[model samples]
Target: MVDNPKESAGRCAQVAGWLTAACQAGHTLLSEPEAKAVLQAYGIPIVETRIALTEDEAVQQAEQLGSPVVLKLLSPTITHKSRMGGVRLVLRTAEEVRQAYRAVAEAAERQAGAGQMQGVTVQPMVTLEGYKLIVGSFCDPQFGPVLLFGSGGRLVEVRRDTALALPPLTTTLARRLLERTRIFTALQHGAAGLPAVDLAALERLLVRFSLLIVEQPLIRECDINPVLAAGDHLLALDARIVLHSIDVPEIALPRLAIRPYPSHYLEN
Candidate 1:
């Protein structure tokens, strides 16, 4: 069975401790910035994003990241951005970047009551084709780390097609997980005019993410939605991370170093 009773009990205790602490601190959950920091510390290949406190800073970041950038309002209260127009995409100029920043800020303020928002996140816009994958991790009552993969984004709820796998995943297992998903057929047939995806990279990423969850118990959940697969390159276009309640004793989180995939292993 995928669920282990003993391990699940321990995980539940850990989660309870975290929730108690959150109540004491008056904080609901880990904010995006906090969650992303934890993810970056791990070996996740996230886009280059910088938090900007001012319009000048946003412009500077746009220049640094180059044109056709993305600007978003960083807020803990706002989760679904598309609903509130909190996300701006394909900003090609400094002026456009500034305008997006203002738009996001205003919308966040109106929708969320008090803004309490960080400036903005200036990120490079990545073009994707093959498939948009949503990979996630959740600590289940019976299973320790339940890893999920599916067709991501707005269609996720619409399609409700996904696959689940247990941790310590191998490349072979990852491929099997993908095959179980309905989206895999389309991805293999060049539905978006892109070549077959680099399944090796996808497997590596999922394994790495699973390891991250095992090492960091404080990470309640993580979502790398729309992991774009274009030919041989896989890019994480958007992400959301949630931390467990605070007040749980701070345990040492293991760190994974980023390294290039072994070439010889591919031959086998």
Candidate 2:
């Protein structure tokens, strides 16, 4: 859950400072864990992941996350994971996770090139009976911050069921944005015998995500793909944030079209 707006603002400021340091150090993308941390701070539900340096460590992490886990090769150089065959899903046992760890690591090294391989990450498999959605935000050269929603998954590129809105969205506006998308139509009317998806929960998630962008101006782009929606639950399966290397002036309000996160309340 999210804290009070003031506290949330403080946390976002803290995260932005850390990311700015990374940007200064020549990092453009936040690693999975770092992205999840930002999302967690904003009260988004994300898949828990742990870095495993070895096969034994991978098995241990899988055990810790519980059975039916997933293994992915974590690397700075490997941007498109599925294309490189760097992802393994549905490892139900420790041995299976161990084997998957080695395979994914080796493949990542081969595909991503030497010295580009980081350790593998262990994540619990998320099984949902509802739609997979995408939620994201980006800085437009002309429009400042823009929020996006759509159908998402392995074939998201092909489907292209997306809608866009400006940041600092109200609940009503966010709902309208969702309603504009084709997936939202399916979600509203029910799909494949599944009951109508939880629009209220999804709306709340989108609103929070918008506020997160308003709070953190350094974020150039963010992707929360396959936001699993089943019944009244929504979970972020995979996420990433891209940072820009521009210096931000310390002002009361950021230079955004929308009202940025209110940091003034933090003093009180």
Best by lDDT: 2
* Tens digit per residue, CA lDDT, model 1, 7-91: 5445456544654565467565555454454455545577777788888999998998898898878776677777788889999
Off by over 4 Å in 2: 1-5, 246-255, 260-268
Clashing pairs in 1: none
Model 1 residue 139 lDDT?
A: 65
Tell me the number of clashing residue pairs for each predicted model. 0, 0
Question: Model 1 TM-score?
Answer: 0.78
Clashing pairs in 2: none
lDDT of 2 at 203: 85
